[model samples]
Target: MREFSEDYLRRTRRGMWDDSREALAPLALESRSRILDVGCGTGELSRVLAAESPSGAEVVGCDADSALLEVAADCVPVVAGDAYELPFPDDAFDLVVCQALLINLPDPEAALAEFARVSSDLVAAVEPNNAAVSVDSSVDAEGDLERRARRAYLDGVETDVALGADARAAFEATPLEVLETRRYDHVRTVEPPYDEGAVVAARRKATGAGLADDRETMLSGGLTEGEYDDLRSEWRQMGRDVVEQMEAREYEREETVPFFVTVGHV
Candidate 1:
């Protein structure tokens, strides 16, 4: 499984559940007695689950990364465990859910089966369709360039990162019965009066550091060395353009990632 840093999770998941949570209706969190947030990195969704559920409801986060669990421990009780072999007993939670977890797992079906084993009532997954993501930017080339890079990354990724609405299949393959699926768009924006994180991101782009991190993956996806170098050069130039625009407070970017909430009954 892939691991993420705390800063990465925080930046990516910022303001996730802040706007509206109508898509979470299928989880029926209000009446849930116990909820388990599997693969709960930094407890983003876990915190949401706790706030939405009943006052006395138990919202426990479980992750293999002890460091992340330590951070999550601040909001709710946490357990150090793997997704395939959860540490809890059968029927330990009324609702078992994971956010942005299935896309990274090699065998999401196996994980779903395990989730059903621990949940007596419902199991849910909030996964993104990376292929369907949309980017709008003040810089014309930024959107297209991002799409190209995203395509290469998706091709190179071993797991099904684009498994959004199709998560129903995984749930149906398990003993659980498919309930419903809803779509939620997680939008992240960058505009005038740039924050510290946005400034750092622009700097990384100017240096091609972001693309450098994915160099191995792009190569695995069949990008030749020369092609990769050319792309990186262009990416850095675009980053420079972004930095220039930011200096004038003319830089603005909006990225929308489509996430599907699939709920199933045990």
Candidate 2:
């Protein structure tokens, strides 16, 4: 498993989670309240929560990876801590917020229970809806291996610490009362400087993973002339399409893809 670097976290935090922050904003306690943000990559949400909290409220962000925490620490008071065993006393916080973290955990339920143990107030979480993938044919067409690979990678400690669809179920078992559920839709159109680097980085990483056949060959800089030409051509075309769409503002009016958001209170 490849542990995510702080650089990776910083790069991702800016672009990902278009929906989670919006869904969490309303449920967040007043600024004066103490809140803890688990898996606070780059402190994006932590900054928002801190600025929005009642004048005196404190926001604390924690992640296990010190590399990421270093970047996050600049924006918020960050601690190196584990979600399963929080370094806080019972009822230590007024609110606990975790987003895109459940699926990444080995024990989602235990993590939530730990949150409940530390906070006297509320526990809010957001996770990808695995069940909802059926609504999008393109993403759904990624096939079994790609799907399994994605799942495995997200669940790995070195990748996205995602907790997929089971986050809500895990939260339901705890003592918190369900407060609200909202769906926020987000549509990402990748192109140019924003996506090119990421795409290349991903392909390089895949190549390093030693995938079988042409895929591995392609990554390892050993693809045949035809294979290289075909793949690169397709990639270039896709990039051009994205750039064109972005230029035409075609995505502005497009409906955001649906992602579930649930809020609960103690």
Candidate 3:
């Protein structure tokens, strides 16, 4: 419930399905295919598919978040809709593709049931590898409270209220036959200047909102040289947790692989 907006997440955070665009190419028809991209945040994936389909496919992306739908509309025909109860008629799409969706839904099975209900042929799904939930908290710090907290925050239901590992289980429960599932470890390098200053400012504002006394000291002197080392440690560990938290794909030959893709059909 404390997560940023969908646009903010796109700008500030690396996605769990960055490679999903290419992964989904094979599942769709050449052209004239009507594809429904459920949970199509920002419409990045839907637009790509629509463009690539030589047959001139119509890719419609849907999301419950209207704010994101505004942004997604720019990329494709975005609808203000929900995955659980799609507004279209039965078997409305030749293919239904949902990448990195199952992992974030509280009722992924229900959503998948909807996917099955609407999809006439295939249902392609991408999800995080539950076995890939590894962490490298090798920081020589005093305690791993930060690491534990970070993991707890991510491993729990997302701030946006999505499922976690249970998403995969829910997908498996679907009546859809498992056509193909691949575990991909990809990482999107997130450089600094990542609006950390804004975070500092927000924290300060929050401290002020609560009328905390140590706001100035905490923002200024509290970030001491020694504290920076701790902060750096926290940052790195938190970054890893973020990748896991987002079900982010792992980069080839990277230290960690946080994202994966899975596709199936009924």
Give the winner by TM-score. 1
Compared with the true structure, model 3 gives a TM-score of 0.64
lDDT, candidate 1, equals 0.91
Candidate number achieving the greatest lDDT relative to the actual structure:
1
Backbone clash numbers for all candidates listed: 0, 12, 18
Arrange candidates by lDDT, descending.
1, 2, 3
TM-score of each: 0.97, 0.66, 0.64
Sort all candidates by TM-score, best to worst: 1, 2, 3
lDDT of 1 by residue, 1-266 (tens): 87899988888876888888887888887789999999999999898888888646899999999999999999999999999999999999999999999999999999999999999999999999888999999988899999989988777889998898699988888888998988888888899899999999999999999999999998999988998899999999999999999999999999999999999999
- Candidate 2 has an lDDT of 0.60
Off by over 4 Å in 1: none
Q: Name the regions of candidate 3 deviating beyond 4 angstroms.
A: 1-4, 12-22, 29-32, 129-147, 155-169, 190-255
Q: List the residue pairs that clash in candidate 1.
A: none
Quote the positional error of residue 61 for candidate 3 in Å.
0.9
